[model samples]
Target: MSLIHVNDDNFASMVQKGGVTMAEFGAPWCPPCKVLLPILEELSAELGDSVPILTVDVDESPVSAGRFGVMAMPTVIVFHDGEPVEKLVGLRSKAAYAAVLAKAAALSPESPAAAR
Candidate 1:
């Protein structure tokens, strides 16, 4: 599965749809953000539909970025049931992101992963 691209317009709606959602707030000029893209893509495929992974370009979605207080270029926020639960700033290991997703999935009552 490919990472869903979101913007200020649809960011809230997409995350509020329910369950656990992982959103990466980044900018096109950010080298780390560019590097992290493929990692997120791999995670998106590994997690399948169990978790919805989204990408937001900070430059284009300043409203959403500012709403989340995303000061870094590659800030990853995990939301459960429309609420932010965990956040990671800057570059992190793929395993670190996976761990955060696992935690978010377990916290969301609507997530199929939560029942496991």
Candidate 2:
């Protein structure tokens, strides 16, 4: 799956749907944010429907960004069961993000492994 672009209007609904959701709060002009975009896309493809990857432009969706207290560009928040579980600020390695998503998926009751 590709990264979903969320604005203030649909951010809550999109995130709270269920399972593990990774939302990147960033801006188009930010260097680090640009750098992280491809990484997120790669993860989105790798994880497929198992994890939902979202992107929010801070400049366009200030409400959502401020609600999450995202003070830095490229703040990636991992949410499980509609609640914030892990927050990573700044640019990070793909493995770091993958690890967090794997942990979140394992913790989610909706996940198959969690059911088992």
Candidate 3:
């Protein structure tokens, strides 16, 4: 599935749905955020509907970013069952992201949205 954009208005509702969700907190102006976008797209395509990816722009959604304590531009938080399970800061390789996603999936094998 494609990345879903979450703002202050929908962030709560979206993440509250549970399951394994990879939420990236960053702003468009952040250089690393720009570089991370394509990598996220690739991961999204690879995972398909198994895992859902969410993009949260810090500038536009300060509440969510602040809640996650995202001090950096590119902060990727792996959430399972609507709660953060892993937090990664800065740019990382696709393999690294995949590992995190795999861990998140492993943590919630019973997740309805988790595609095996």
Counted clashes in each candidate structure: 0, 0, 1
What lDDT tens digits, residue by residue, belong to model 2 across residues 1-111?
999999999999998556889999998899999999999999888777778899999999999999999999889999998999999999999999988888888886668
lDDT by residue (3-114, candidate 1, tens digit) is: 9999989999889456889999998899999999999999988878888899999999999999999998799999988899999999999999998888887766667666
lDDT sort, best first:
1, 2, 3
The Cα local distance difference test for each model comes to 0.89, 0.88, 0.86
TM-score of 2: 0.92
Give every collision pair in model 3. 1-48
Q: Candidate 1: lDDT over CA atoms?
A: 0.89
* Candidate 3, poorest ten consecutive residues by summed lDDT: 107-116
Candidate 1, residue 84: CA error in Å?
0.3
* Per-residue lDDT over 1-116 for candidate 3, one digit per residue giving the tens place of the 0 to 100 score: 78999999998778745577889999889999999999999999987877788999999999899998999979999888788899999999988998888888877677543453
TM-score, each model? 0.92, 0.92, 0.91
